[model samples]
Target: MHLFRSMATLVSITGASLILVGCGQKSGQQKETITTSTDSELTTVDPSKTTAVGTFNVLNNVDEGLVRLGKDSRVEPGIATSSTVSKDGKTYTFHLRKNAKWSNGDPVTAHDFVYSWRRTLNPKTASQYGYLFSGIKNADKIQNKKAPVSSLGIKANGDYQLTVTLEQRIPYFKLLMGFPVFFPQDSKTVQKYGSQYGTSAKTQVYNGPFTLTQWTGTNLNWTLKKNPTYWDKKHVKLDNVKFNVTKDPSTGLNLFNENKLDMAQLSATQAKQMKNNKDLISRKQSSNYYIALNQKNKVFKNLKIRQAMSMIINRPMLANKVIGGGAINNDSFVSKDLAVSPKDGSDFTQDVTAPTSMGYHPAEAKQLFKQGLQEVGRKSLHFTLLNSDTYDQKQLSEYLQSALEKLPGLHVTLNNIPGRVILSRQADHQFQATVANWFADFSDPITFLNILTSTNPSNISQWKNAEYDRLIDASNNDDGGNAEARWNDMVKAQNLALKDQAIIPLYQSGEKWLVKKSVKGVIYNTAGANYNFKDASVK
Candidate 1:
């Protein structure tokens, strides 16, 4: 079934209203709780296997790694209480907090992390995020099946001591540890559930501030209850967190008006209409949304055709006129707020300029399109454009179709499906072109640039450039210890990708929401899960 329709049905449920029941304070007790809505349903609960935003939201509360994002986006100790790096910056040793324990009453030790990391790096796991572990010694070899998983550079010196070796210096390694991919998993629980692990709440174990319940793997509603076993439970004020999957803007607004939800994500139109509302808030996310043209398609393989397609879209109009509320037009694939130049400390986006071919020019686009058609011996070109079925995605796809169809002899057909279906289709290379977005896993340019490499599983475009690959390799391996040299290499690689029109960048997303004034202390990170409710409270 299409996920959008399923979510709509879930949101339409009346009577009983689980939101009130879940968020209400118990009798004679002063407890805080929150009711919120996500744009879509969660795709997975397993930390190592998930790539969806909704899934990350749940995992951030139910599981944790060596470090976690604290209030105000500060890095705080989680399983590990302290850590030290070698003088060469190639080795790190962590001392685990002995008080940490899983929800099932099992101790969370360094061995759990070793087991989890090896599982994620194993080729049998088929994790798309395996590329994230590249800098760890032997990680690439393990992913390529050239070395055994046991050979990966992680060791449990004792129950509380964990040591890690790296091939080169990674300035953002601490930040990377806060991501879900690096979280630990219980070996016994994983073996007990076998393939069913993390498919539903029943098959998962929690080691963080909350425990998931009532998730049937296909439902649109779920509940998060405070985990009494959490090591840092004293700081967790929320007794429960109720989440409802909402796809329609009208429904979310109605829920917010009815006081059934403490926070609701708003559409651009809704934000404009309710701009005067005191509860309205806007969050500028560090993310990039773009269109990925599959180079496997014969028509898309032409460089002039790709450049023409990219140049025809008016990004400013899309960001301001179509989707307002502070959404910024982006000429490059890397987000504006992602990172800074190591040499000058200036924002990465400000330090680099996009290639001329990526700029908007209708006349030049028409001429290039005509030349491309002549070169490919075609009078007209037609291709399907794939996107999610959410309200915003539908609008974005329609806008693209209208703009691209204005070019002579070019036709675009949009296929709007469920979010899950769109992800599967992209991974399988089932579309000629598609609109997609990438949220950075860490605060670095390599987090965005590494995905487009030829061997990275996330490169759905099937674009392979020898020079681009060489630059990325050098940034990660050869000059990784030299921050300035690594930054220059990455910038050159991004420029080359733009010159070749690897992808057409549209705009960086801006999150708009209506949040209750009583809620406080929710941490919003520039990378990873985006939200952390560990210290959240409602008065």
Candidate 2:
């Protein structure tokens, strides 16, 4: 359920004066290549279809949106040279760069953006990301099949000029433009390939910093060659970026030791062992991990049972002892270090408080468990906890099983599967409970809070409350113009969700890595695509 987004770049430099090694080839024509590894296999290269971290990593490099999340998470112009907002803030007009072109040498125009947006909102596309276009006029109606895609409130005034009308003013609309879901599509290529489009590297086209190559329908390895047609190709330093799928931490570490990789992520245990290693670096990610209790299950339908489940786990211990590397213990769904209150510029996490029941209270939990079991008229309860097959996820599931079984008449089992399979199963509601993480798609608290809304396609837990929905709706409409009022409404909604025990928040993740000193200029953001290697170079 974790919609993977930004990853922070952790770099280790020990010397004040560093030697710069030129990675140039003898011919001075071939570009230098950098190698990296990912833990999960990519699901798709299509911007509209991708939902996993691996796919986002590739697309973030290979495709260019109207605007791109640049170094330090700042918004930078991409295909669009500049933009202007109407006085009322309901309309946006983008002026595209005339030199931008796709990999096939075709001009990238405003129509491309219009077509891509409409296609994403088309009911036939079945895009889970269409929800992101909610504020765009008629976007929600189009996605819900109530209106034609032609009415989506976006139009191409000319080859380089585009206009977008919003149903309401969206504070984060510019940031939203940087997301992969908002990237333009090559309609000709998509229609030509039909279902085969984006299934393999050969079927795709690129207009960003890199062009995907050497990726078949399924493979453990792929290459991203610099896109010569890119408008800002002069700024793209690396000749190529080679990526290999390495799910095993030991194997990734071994690769890094052998000088085969420029960067590799380390597990908590590995990171602890290498704490003194000069190459070790840690990054605090803007994400939250939690166990989503499926409300559709008869046992979980009891509020007491859900509360008991939430209280049994020691989140601080899990974050520090089990999943160390700067992981922060979190009880609220919205991650800390993400947003701030517009009224006083105070941290959002500090303004809201989860109920005390969210903390470890085994004594109270036992009493709640007893009451819950009696309410359900069950003498004993047994359920399986689903999780990813990764070493860390498996360890987390085992820890939860051990802790939850302490309750009387509770028998817990663990089921670990591949990351993709786990996501698919969760989407199908095939589990009673599962451990999941959600990375912010944007900077706002709404990025995390909106997912649990009654109508969100990403609501795997199936938890719903009328008041919660009302608060979120009010924040978007009644309080839309008032930042302070909207912030208060969101904070209230978060408290209500936690009070209902909608999901048990465990910790906010922190990425740990071993990176080569030679790799430089890599941009990591807290939102959108986590990593951007467009400016990266091996020196």
Candidate 3:
């Protein structure tokens, strides 16, 4: 499950987007005279928002969920010490920590989850992740304006026990609970701050391992200081965790080389160049990169054209030469190695597989293009491939543009924009096609695959199949269905998604990162995404 393109990460943009630095400075102006050991070009810091790097760093040292993802990527008790679910996996009863209190010295309770979920789905929050909870009973109805917030399937059994009822059986529901959107909010704080809640460090209180020190509302750089109130404070060892936004891979690498940045993404060229370095480490993250066609658009309506697009490119070469060698050839929308593969703990030994049609053959691509042109009664066509303007994405998009033009009737245009603008276009459906990668918030295929499908609320690609939708509905409705049989149905749905050619499946994802080996307790879960730093301590 890819989040932030791999593990469970979410960075949906809203009104004003700023890269949150894990510091207490609102302007991200740090104590310049302090003995700062790392270096980078982190310009702004805001509390209202955070970058992928900032979110993860803050997750462990600052934000505390009812439960947290352990360093092993498995679920462990957070504020809640233990939880019990009904036999059918429909209702979850959580036993919250009696002494677990917020930074404000307020006790955290089950109602926090209820309030957070409702606030996220409140229509006004406009949380794109609100759809992530659609599977919850009444969630869809409330989000769709078909029901009331009170009807949401959660009840506060007294104050400590949160009894949650899902719409159907979700074997992986517990893992989903560990995602960021599901994290609890302070009711009093949210109401008092209103729109300003979650917008700044001063406005928010810490319940996790670290507390936000100096981040302003604008995101750029910030730090996480040890939280004295953390129940398990003894297990957290880092005196402070700093976050810097390194959007440009080359610049990030430069800073890393200069010893200004401890960790950063390497350019494909930089990664290859540094492959032999003592500090470089590559991980096959649970994420995939691919294009999504807005089926509602006429250009994407023809399957042949879609197939033609898929067949023209050489994915393997792109992975090795353009996107960085560590990127797996992701032809399947879901990471084949996602979730803890029962067959093996490692992704290489996982049971996940790509779609049958996920392949590249120049001859096949040309043939599909010809067929598509004939269907549309056109000899040639033009379209643009939209992508985020980041360095790696630019290289990847440009490479695809050159490759796709191999087909005689195709004229591909590359449209790259800032991250903020790209997110806007995706939400507003302003482009014909987009190169987007989805990450999972939990260790389940549905978390990634289902959202890309045509019937999904987040399905910007407008294609829909009755059979595909039916199968998903069936899986969710299966109360006593055999587990193996359920898997068969899921495969059927994924296969149908492939068969429609509505969206092209690229290679499954692999994570790649560079870390200072001294940082221990950063657990890596092969199932869902995200690095758990709850117990991680710097040597």
Candidate 4:
């Protein structure tokens, strides 16, 4: 569910220096590449690997999905030109445009979807993301090896009509389709190349607006040439998108100053320095940064300790001091500004849960810790908090360690590991409490809440409330996704989650990035995946 949009150049998202050099001969001079961070180390772009900045940054242009999210956060056609839903909402049929073709000029067909889903769910493939498709028929059973892959709920009626069936009603189904998990794959290419398929540009084929060119499996740079077979070939304007990974902020900034990088991520210091500047592009997203307590631990199971931990942290200090102004202290697990109003603009959620406690309050936090300790009959508590080893994660972890110790009886230990390791440990439920962040896979509340269900593979925290799960189920089924009723169900769900205090909400993200003035048509979207490089252009 960790879907990527923009590629970061350095470890830090905020502005860094650029170090990765561009690839291919200089045919026509264009604007420089955009890095999500200001870092200076260069990393290679590989399409098969899941990377935030790399895939969507430049190499993503060559990849074709069934549907693409447009600048308006609306579902737009990609491989499939049009689709229709059943009156019961259980069946969705799509019509693939006749002209859509792979980079090899072979027609991309509905069977591609059928083949791809089976491939991703093939237990031998061991794709961790197979759970995202559980809403489809027999997906869970297949992933669990209880059923064969053929039972998956996708059918190719012809060269054009791709039909899908859900286990039940799902509201964000379209948004799920917009995700890369559901994108089609050419059966022949994948079978022929075996393990080497999609590892390099030459090994794979394209059907989107761009055709990838000149990327070896380990190359730090890649180029995407426009695909003439795109359905809307006329509107697919950019000739190609070139990407290079730069891992240092200072060097990235140097490139920015020299007009080489078109856009870059800013560091806390950099954002603080440039926030008010006209060139800074800041966006507040519907993402919540929080700490997930593994309830399996006897110490963490104590509500008193949970409440104490929640109360003591200074959220505003982190927002104001470390994160700067683009972030706001969050109370509800779901970030504000996401589906706050109905399509017709009416309030949906009633503020039933106590407002999220954000900002620094050492005194009250110490008192709560004392109260919790006394109630639990414990003289002191010890626990390790895990986080990803990224700079932001380390920064946040260190700050939390200092803040939590101020509480007399609470001693916090910090462990910073690779993001992949962090994810693995989390899935294994191997920590006391961990800093967890979620970027929405789609534009629905269910996208955030449903994944935390007791049975979900991604439910790493093992925090489950039957009532909360029920509400989420209602939102996905009866309420019909992103609806006012669904939002109401979400408000109810978050309130219940707060009442249980299984997790603490910290701050919401403000989608902040510094884009040099010359970049255009980056295909930015507020919801779902944020950017598409296919249409990106440099003037």
* lDDT leader: 1
lDDT of 4: 0.63
Model 1 poorest 10 in a row by lDDT: 10-19
Which candidate order results from sorting by lDDT in descending order? 1, 2, 4, 3
Please write out the lDDT profile of model 2 over residues 433-534, one tens digit for every residue: 887777777789988888889888677789999999999988876787789999999999999999998888888878678888888887877655677889
Worst 10 residues of 3 by lDDT: 14-23
Candidate 3 TM-score versus the reference: 0.85
- Backbone clash numbers for all candidates listed: 0, 3, 56, 38
Would you estimate the TM-scores of all the predictions?
Answer: 0.94, 0.94, 0.85, 0.83
> Which residue pairs in candidate 1 collide?
none
Clashing pairs in 2: 2-437, 6-530, 7-530
Query: Positional deviation of 229 in candidate 2, in angstroms?
Result: 1.7
lDDT of 1 by residue, 177-219 (tens): 9887899999999999999999999999999999999899988
* Runs in model 3 lying further than 4 Å from the true structure: 1-57, 340-357, 479-481, 526-529
Where is the poorest 10-residue window by lDDT in model 2?
A: 11-20
lDDT of 3 by residue, 1-539 (tens): 11222111212211001121111111233221111211122211122222232243344447777777775566778778888877866788888888777889987888877888887777766655666676678987887788988888888888888888888777777777776667787889878877676666787887877787676756555666777887888776666666654556566556555655555555567777777888776655555566778887776798888888888778788787877636667666666566543333444213345443467778988988898898888899888888766556677778888988999978889997655455557666788888765555566666666665454545667778888877776666662235555565666777777767767755544434444544555555544434445555444
Which parts of model 2 are misplaced by more than 4 Å? 1-30
